[model samples]
Target chain A: MWGGGADMADPALRPIQRDWLSKTLAGLVLGAILALACSGLFARLNTAMPLGVRGQLAMWMVPPVWLGVLGGVYFFSSGVRAWLWLGAASAFVTGVFYLL
Target chain B: MRSEFVRIYKAVHTWTGIVAGMALFIAFYAGALTVFKEPLAAWASPPVAGRMVPLADTPKLIAGVLAADPATARDFTIHMGDAEHVPGRMGWQVRDTDADDHDESSVRHYVGTLDATGQARIEASHPSQLASFIDVLHRVVGLPVDSDPNRWVMGLVAALYALALISGVVVLLPSLVKDFFALRLGKNLKRMWLDAHNVVGIVSLPFHLVMALTAVVFAYHDGIYIVQDKFVHDGKWGTAFQRQQPAAAAPGRDPASMLPPLELIARAQAFAPGFEPTALQYQQVTGPRAVVRVWGKDAAAVSPRARGGFAALDPYTGKVINSDFLPGRQSTPNLFVSSFFALHMAAFGGTAVQWMYFLLGLAGAWLFYSGNLLWVESRRRKRPRDGGEVPAQRRDVRLMAAATVGVCLGCVCGISLTIVGAKWAYALVGDANAWLLPVYYTTFFGCIVWAFLQGAAKAAVHLLWLAVMAALAIPLTSGLAAVAPGLNMWVNTSLSSLGVDITACVGAAALGWMARATARRVRQGGADSVWSEGPQPCLQGGVPGVGVQAK
Candidate 1:
């Protein structure tokens, strides 16, 4: 997605040795899972609400949660850590979703 | 954030922006025009003959049309206004079954009206699709069709845009306080462009945030609903929105027995006093679960959708079935969600708010365009101290400039020419709807090719001039229509249509000014920059940031 690392030759880029490619891919994938899990948990908690209302709320929740993950995913120092932590968070959320 | 993190975020902001900026330019530019969708539709629609049917006669018109053609009973609308594009008191659309749900271009429009004798007359009107065509471009970032795949691509772009917004704020956090609203119109072109970009982005950060989040939901809401059905609603999502059915079976309801359109509006008005009814949409009127939604705007409240909020009422009893989506009448939770839609669609605070959104949208477009300009300007290599040669610019810089010039200006020219083509196509081919896409794509691709062939510097000026001409043609077409009626073209004197022409005139003046500035830059600006018309020379040593400054 970074498209050939066109600015790789720039001195400013040399210091950042993190795995951007894997981190971005992890953000895309795990962030979606985490978003879906959050939405599922939201729906379960609001099960008593009318489907018309709850469904809309759930659908709208996905973007922010997913984008939140994508935006903050870079805070991790490396792609491996990003994947591990996001993976753990997604698992926790999914477990909570099923438990409800 | 640490300095290292800021630097990393700066890179993130740059890459994400470069990837999504051009597409967002089309989205924001076209989106700005879409704020006046009704006006654009009115401007493009040829005037219909005869006066509109009276509001009192709309019930009769609906009964007559339904009796004549029962298929229309599935869904139809009775417009309450005298807008130029309203066609008549009653209008409905028959959409192609396979067309994307958001695709309005394939829909056939029909209007029912009472003739001189008070008999129902149904006319198939070919209302121009120019407004919706531009809307489709805005929705899917210049895609011709609003299909699922295209929307997913739009979803990707929206995600990238969200990332860019976040990273951009992070990158600016250090200098944000010091440079708030700073506009240094100085010789340091790169700093000037950066300041301008930062100011727009930061000031409109909330607006862009709403746009990005809402756009993501719009692009992927269908999938989200499917997921919601599986994990959230336990696969009952499809039936949840359905109205409750009675146990006793009965034949199809009679349209004539249903309440009049005026009664529905009255009921809606009673439910929410300030909610003005613009149209009465009768859905499944003949079916057991019949619903008549009185749709309109309430200037004081937020609407759930672009068509404004609606109060769903039972056609037989005139009882309000649902006010969940009604403006000024929604529950607090529902209203909270509705605010999102209202903010994104400019469905609140009336025309003043609409104008604000329009200007903000244009400024957003300029933000992205200036980002590209800053990109090219920052990468510029300067002339050597010896003054013997001009350093050759990187291939990426030249390519980015070309793409930026091609895509952004192409969209502007394409939309303008296509808008102007609506009347001409109607005059010549007798059907304007079919010519919209072809004319737009032809102009769009032609501009892109011109950019690549002429190079960014020369093509930017040329395309800007072309854009000026195309935008100017909008009002000229209307002017000619009024003066020379023999051309079979038309002009609408209504405020909405006239507003479109006036806006286009202003747009043309802006484009004209940019064209002049760009031409001067190409002719007399920096010799070592890609924007210059002068020849590039390969040199071993060149001093950076020591040459002529750009505007």
Candidate 2:
């Protein structure tokens, strides 16, 4: 009965889920970098954009990075693993930004 | 792990709900009333004489008032009371420097008419005491006579409510996806009650959440002292306020010099770009280093009350010294905090938002009522012992029934009486708001006590009927006094009063419906019958003094 239950079967698939989580995190990081670069280029092209509007656009950077953490958890094998990955990714990304 | 998470969340939800439920009930109820604060205020205040002062004349009128009462010029505030035609007026409050004591004793010093030469004449109208009373009720809940301890008690209750909501959401998570829209009716009383509670909770979850969180913030503003001390005062806990004091005050010491009000307004406009200056002040007026402060509205901001920018002008020269708009980066936290207020108060998107909040508020009220009902129903399955000696089950029944009828109907009675008190105060003393608010609240609390003494069924029926009558009398009283015709004329010309009358009519209808429903329930259930009378009680009688009986 325990073997037939969804709970027991879920752990067998954990390794595959871990791989998916790592892939998703990598994709999100790449996407964020590209988007930031594009926004910088767009701002250079459009000089008339108000300072407030530019600031608002810049604030959009925080939410996406936060969302990537959540996305990584959703694809992970377990909540603990998901949290670990999220913490690591967040630290690395935040550190990179701080260094820049 | 999942099960453990669920268990923790369930505990949180239950405790939070239990603690915060009563305060949330009061908050949501009074907040619903506060939606019409402006109209209610107008209804409380007497009609103003003369046409509304022209926009152009406002500055002149204000100037005249300041010149006449030179003492008031130090620190003063003006309110543009309502719009024209429907008793719209203007008033001001000036600090009474003449007082011997150092404590501020500002008086409601009115400036009525601006003469042909643009001079102000003193005018007096009663303050919207009823609306203000309702506002206090919405905020602190404990009126003056209720004892000061009630405020702290309510604050603690609010915090508990936040906890309950969090715990509730946690408990619901496991079953949420499967039974998101589940509402099984017909038999299985416990299941039915659970379904009802869940449905109400989930449907109005967003509103309830925002309201709970913001209410906690408001109730526990003192908690911010921790953050203020750490972040605001260079890591020093108690000295934050002292540090900010110098910056907040006037920079210069000029007592004799004053800036041209229009120039200050113009400078403020320059800072905000599109915003109109709503208020202006000259700080340290007579000194050589006087500064003019200009404050105004920014339509793009989340709330109309959100202070956009400040422009300080050198009073003697009319030169702009500081032009500062709230920086977009720094404004994010403020925007988030204010968005909570806007969401809770339905002040952001105007009428549509107000209606949405009203519906949500009603739903929240229903959620609490249903929750209590569920508790009663769950216990009702266990039958009380036969005969005169009160079984613990029976006592539980009586108390829950009393609370259900007393608190809910008592609120209705209180609000209705407050309206009546407003009218009566106006009729008898000409200034109704002052006395009407306290009278209505007294009547409301009396109803609660009255409900407790009587059986729940009887109390419910009586108060429901009383509410219907009171609500109906609102329009009738106005009509009989010929105020209705003038009110109708005003309603045709103004949306505010029309909305007020329509809301009153709707309230009358709702009370009438409640009366009928209570009467029907009384008829079906029979007089003196307790809610917990059947077989289901036996299945869940683990608690002492409660027992299940065979049919």
Candidate 3:
């Protein structure tokens, strides 16, 4: 359904009619969980560092990791797979975080 | 990698850019001004009559003031330099608990000096809120107040902005090598706009990335700390940073017996040779955990914070207590994290870097404006080639164009007009600080209404001229104040204040040029585009249908 080049000089090379809604939800919810879990894990692992400094480093790490996930989520082939895979990854990270 | 992935990223980039572009425009524009926030504050404040107390007499001054007014003993700043904004040698602020945490306007300012007979002279001082108002606009994306809700909004915008940056890079990967420094200025307006947008976006990618990340951190830092406290520190984060308390309750230390200001500066300079101590901030000097923070910057090193790093010292012993935040003396790990704050706030490399950041900030604002322009251009419904009736542009496209023009130029007009209004408000009402927000919001919303009532094509030019005139008025008011002493207005001829006027003159000239160019484009350029004046016989020289590739 992506065929229009008569008048417009440039058009899309392929259609991008993916499951945008579910992909967005997965990115927003699961990405945040993963980022928070990773931050907590880092803070826990770096016990040698001062608590203040380590906590600061951990707090600063959340936005970049979360945004990185949000930016990469659309590369998944399907929205359901995107949700399932990200959910499993988040679960693993969170499980480790809780164990610590 | 694949064409399909590129297409998807392209869509992501376009939508995010469209949604966050206008707010980012306001942020970058005001942020550029905030780079010189100190100078703007100096320019806005009227001259005070009190001279700075001599450095040797500061101990007596502090003692006398503290005995007279015990409230200031909690926290107070001793000014070393004589800037126009420094009301007295010693000053402190009493902030209203009801106001927002970030709100500076609700704070009551008091400054103390020694009178002729050596008695303490304390008065309620009124400093200008102009700079802080502009900073609030920058911090919260043109929100009226720097409240928690506004910061959350800014955080969401920053998140979207980060997403856009990533998707934008992905979309441009294929053409990255070929279009590094390419700026094709030809009949193809779309291509020219696209090239300009790409050059600015890619060249300043690092700056934009730092801003996006730091902005999110600044907005939600309270929330981040809460999460960290709950999960990582188990609600004991506060105790870790607290100072070690004495075993028994100690007697109150005397402010009079503390080390002199010069001695404190010497101690800080000895600790870090390159650090220039501008002020000494005494926190709880009368209490058991008395500490003095020597605040200033070392030009050769990256400052840990915007106001600059400080070396904390024991006020009584003249011993350095903490050098972790000192500019040239930070630990390696601290320096790594401070680099992010330094890069975001332009706290390194001094004046040349500040000017570079100013120009880069303007270019960033242009990036957003051009992004919106490209969007409207791509959606333009061209006239039939056979000379049929002109097709009306899509309502969404028209609405977007109007909103972009209104929001962006309205911000320009609002800021300039409010700056000029400061002088008038001071002269007329005797307190310009109280009237800053009313002046800004009135002009901001007024321009928005004007843009909607008059279509985008007309409103863009009108607001541009309004911006030009308003900017020109800044220097003109100063000139009038200088010549006409009868007007009872003040003019500070300090280098920093004059810098504000001179920069405004340059800004006015630039806005004038843009107004002329936009007027020409509306009258004579593409008749079918959203920027055009009205319906016309045929399309102009531009290729009507060729859009920016993958836009």
What are the DockQ scores of the candidates, in order?
Answer: 0.40, 0.04, 0.40
Flag regions of model 1 displaced more than 4 Å.
A1-17, B536-551
lDDT per residue, candidate 2, B304-330, as tens digits?
Answer: 232333456665676776543332212
Return whichever of 1 and 2 wins on DockQ: 1
Model 1 interface RMSD, one decimal: 3.0
RMSD of 3: 6.4
TM-score of only chain B in every candidate structure: 0.95, 0.77, 0.95
For residues B337-436, write the lDDT of model 3, one tens digit per residue.
7888999889988888889999999999999999998888788898898998777787677778888998999888899888888888999889897788
Task: Supply the global lDDT for candidate 2.
Answer: 0.55
Worst 10 residues of 3 chain B by lDDT: B535-544
Error of 2 at B99 (Å): 14
The best candidate by TM-score is 3
Q: Residues B132-228, candidate 1: write the lDDT tens digits.
A: 9999999999999988999999988998899999999988999999999899987788999999999999999999999999999889898888877
Q: Rate the local accuracy (lDDT) of all candidates.
A: 0.87, 0.55, 0.87
